[model samples]
Target: MHLPSRPDLTKSVFGPQSDFIAVVFSPVLAEWDEGAFCMPLLDLLVARGYQVHVYDSLSLAQESSTLHATSENWDAYLRANYPQIDLAVGQAYGGALVNSLLSGFLKTCPRVLGLSAPTRCSAELQSNLASILTCLDMQGETAALDLLEYYVKPERNDKYQPLPPTKVEESGIGQRLRIGFSQLMKADARSHVNNYAGHMLQIYGAASRLVNTDSIVVSSDNRRQISSGISGCGMRPVIEAPEIALRLISDFLD
Candidate 1:
C-alpha cells in the first residue's frame, strides 16, 4: 500500500504570536485543500497578525500511519497539539469536524461558533439511505466501490473511467471513503455532517443566509443561491465571515 505522506502544513501558512488562533478543518472526504470556503478568513487573520493554522484533516487521516483521520482522530489531534486553539471554521463536511472539535477544544476557550453547521443528525432519511446503500451492496469491503457506481461516478457500461472532479482538489479521500462515509452518516452524529447530509445541509443553509452577517465573503455564487434554490431551500440573510473570523481569532489567542 502507498503510505500517505504529511504535507508540510506549517510551512505553508503563517502562525503569529497573537492572542487568538483559528484552525480550519476540512471535509470528511479527506485531504484539506486551499480553495476551502474559509480560506479567505485565514488570509484575513494572517493580515491582522494573529497566528493561523489550517488543519488538513484529510492529510492527517491519510498520512498519519498511526491515525485513521476520522472525526475522532481529528478531535484527538486538536486536544493534543492545539489544546489552546480558540476559534475554528469549516465548510460542508468540514463544518461537522470543526463543530465536534469545538465540543472538546472549547474547554480551553470561552465560547465557540459554527458557520453553517448542523446541530443534529437527520432521522427522516433512513429508508432512502437504506435503499441506496442496499443497491450499492454496502455489506462488503467493496461497499465504497458499490456506492461510487451508484452515486459519485457517472453510470456507464464501463466502470473504469475518470472520476468526477470534487469541489475540493486532491483525492486521497477516495470516492469509496467519501460515499461510504456519507451513507454511514445518515443518522450517526459523528458521521452525519462530517459524513455528508449535514455538510450539504449546512452549506445549503449558509448559502441561503450569507447576506446579513459580515463574518464571511458573500461570493456572487452565494448571492445567486440567496435568490434561487440552494441545495433545496430559498435564500435569507446570514452571517458574513471576514470580521467574525478576525474577531474569533483575536479572542481565541487572548
Candidate 2:
C-alpha cells in the first residue's frame, strides 16, 4: 500500500545550510542525551551536511502524550509526523522500529544506520530486561539504571564496569523507562531486516549478549545490507567509543 504524498517536514526540522535530511530514532532513556552517542554523532552527521532531527519517544511519552512504542506502529507515526525521510538512524530500541518501518512502509528511504539495534531480542535479553524492570519496581529509578548500565555496557571479554546513573530525577521517570524497556525486550525486526530493500548498516558490540545477531543474516545478494561488530566496545559501541562508531558510519554512508 502506497502512503499518500505529504507536505514538507515542519520548519523546525529544517536547516538553512543543510543538503540532506536525517532523523535519529533515539533509544529508551530519559537521559538519552547524556549518552556519548547523542552529541558526537549528531555533530558528525551535521558536518556531513545532514540536517538531523532526533525523535526520542520517552521524552514525549508523558501520561497525556499519544506517541506509541512498539515497532508495528512507528511507521504510521513517522508517516504522520515526518513524511520525508532521507536517512533513517535508529539507536537500539529505535533501531528495531526503523527496521520495521523500512521493510514494510518506508522501504524507499535511501539508507539506514542502526547503532546497537535490538532487531532480534533473545531469551537472555528478555530475562535481563525483566530483571531490570523488577529492579525498577523494587529498588527505584537510580538503582534500575545502575542495573541497566551493568547489563548493557561491557568491555573486552564481556567484563562490566560499575558506572553511576547519569540522571537523578523524580520517580515519574521510572514509569517512562518501564514502558520503553518493555517495548525494547519485545521488539523483533528480523523479518523487516530480511525484506528491507534500502541500504543498511547495523553495528553491535562484539560481546553483546543482550542482542543476538546470530540469526540476522544480511544476504550478500543485497550488498547494501551489512552488519558488523566492534570488538572490545561492548554492547554500546556508540557510547563506549563514539569515534569508532562515527568513523564506521561515515565510511558506510559515504
Candidate 3:
C-alpha cells in the first residue's frame, strides 16, 4: 500500500477565510512526516470553517529552543502569526505543548482540547522513552519503531497507513527526537490545566497505554470527556477513528 507523500508542514494551510484559527501540533515520534498523522484532524477543522495551522513541533524545536521555553515566547509567536485563535487542539506530545502554554500565554482564554495527552510524566516513563531513543541511535530505525510500538501500542487503522520508514541519520532526525522527548518529559500539564479559565474537552482511548487518562481532568464550567472502548483504539484515538474524533471535536467546538 502506497501512502501519500507527506505534506510540507511550512506550506500547508487550510480554511483561509475563517475568522477562527486553530493550531495543531503533531506527536513527538511522528514529527519527521507530521502530515500523515495530523491531516485527518486538519481537514476536519478546515471543513468546519476553521483556519488551521499545523506545525511540526520537532522541527520548530530544532530551529529555536526558546519557542517552548516560556509562556511569553509562546504568546508572542501565536499573536504574531494569527490575529486571533478561537481554539487550540493538540495530540499526544503536541497536547502537552498546548497545555503548557494555555495558562500563561493565551490571554483570550480560548477553548482547549487535548487528545490522549498526559498531564504528568513519571521517572519510569521518561526512562522508557529514553531507551527508545537509545535504540534508534544505537541499533536503527527499525529497532526504535519496534520499541515505540510496544510502548505506545497505537491502534491500527486502515484509513491511515503508516508513515514511510526514514533513517535516523537523515536530516538530523535523531537529534530532533531527543529534543522532543526531553521537552515531553519536562512538561507538566496539570498546573496549566488547573489554571486555565476556559472550557476544555479531553478525549482518550480505553486501550491507551501511553497516557494515563485518569490523571487528566477539566476544571472549567464547560467540560466534556470521552473514553472510546473501541478495540485497539490506543493513544491515537483520532487516527484510529477520525470520523468519531471529528464529530466529537466539532460538537464540542460548536
Candidate 4:
C-alpha cells in the first residue's frame, strides 16, 4: 500500500487564545481560507470564547491516499498539535472528511457539527459526481463553477456564492482536483459515523440535490448523533440560512 504523506496543514488560527478549540474544514468548492462560506457559525463560535483553527489546505491534499488514510493524517495532525479538541465543524466535503476522522480517532469523542454531510456515497451520487469530475478535467474551474451553480440553483438561496473562477495558471491544483474527485467518488463515511462515539449534529438542506439527506445515516447505536434538515436551502445551508444555522449550532453548543 502506498502510504500518503502528511499534508503540510499551514492553517490559520483566528479568535482569541482560549481553552476551547474549534477546528474547521472547508467545503470542496471553496479554499479553506475563504472562511465566509462557513461564516456566522464560525464567527458565532469565536464570539462564544472558542479559539477557531481554520485549516487552509487543499481539498484532498493527498492524491493517492484512501479516504481512511486521508482521515488518519488529519487525526495525526490534530493529535500532534492540540492537547484536546472541544469541537469539530466542517461543511460538505470537509464535513464528511471530519466525520470520518472523528468516527475513529480521539479517545473521547468531541462535539461535532457537520453541514450537508453525507456518510455514504450512493451509486446515483457517484454517477452525478462523475460529470463534474469530467468538467473539471476538461474545462477547468470556470466550467466546474457552472456545474456547481446548477447544484445550488434549486435552493433559491443566493447568499452562498462559490469563489469566482480563477485565472491563475497553477497545474498542481488541477491534478489535485482530479485526484480529490477520484477519492471522493469512492469515499464512504458511513463506517466512520457508525463508529463515532461523539455527540454530533448532521445538518443538510432539504432541497439539496447534491446529496440525498435520507442517505446520511447516523447509526442508531449513537444516541447522541442528531440529523437535521434545513428548508429553503441546498448544499450551502450555512450561508443560505445563516440565522437558522447559527441558532441550531448555538443551541447545540450551549
Better of 2 and 4 by TM-score: 4
Enumerate residue pairs that collide in model 2.
none
Candidates 1 and 3: which is better by TM-score? 3
Residues 7-61 of candidate 1 have per-residue lDDT tens digits of: 4532234556777776665434323355444555566667766576665545443
Best by TM-score: 4
Descending-TM-score candidate ranking? 4, 2, 3, 1
Off by over 4 Å in 4: 1-8, 30-32, 57-60, 155-173
In candidate 3, what are the lDDT values of residues 1-254, reduced to their tens digit?
11123243243456787777787766776434645676777887888888877666553454335335633445556655566678777777777777777765453556777887666665656776788777776766666766777667653442323333555454555566667776776667666677677767777676655665453555544344333333456777778777787787778878
Per-candidate TM-scores read: 0.48, 0.79, 0.78, 0.84
Candidates sorted by lDDT, best first: 4, 2, 3, 1
- In the order shown, what is each candidate's alpha-carbon RMSD? 11.3, 5.0, 7.3, 4.4
Between candidates 1 and 4, the one scoring higher on TM-score is 4
In terms of lDDT, model 2 sits at 0.68
Tens digits of per-residue lDDT, candidate 2, 7-34, equal: 4221124334565789887777646453
Top lDDT model? 4
What is candidate 3's TM-score against the reference? 0.78
RMSD of 3: 7.3
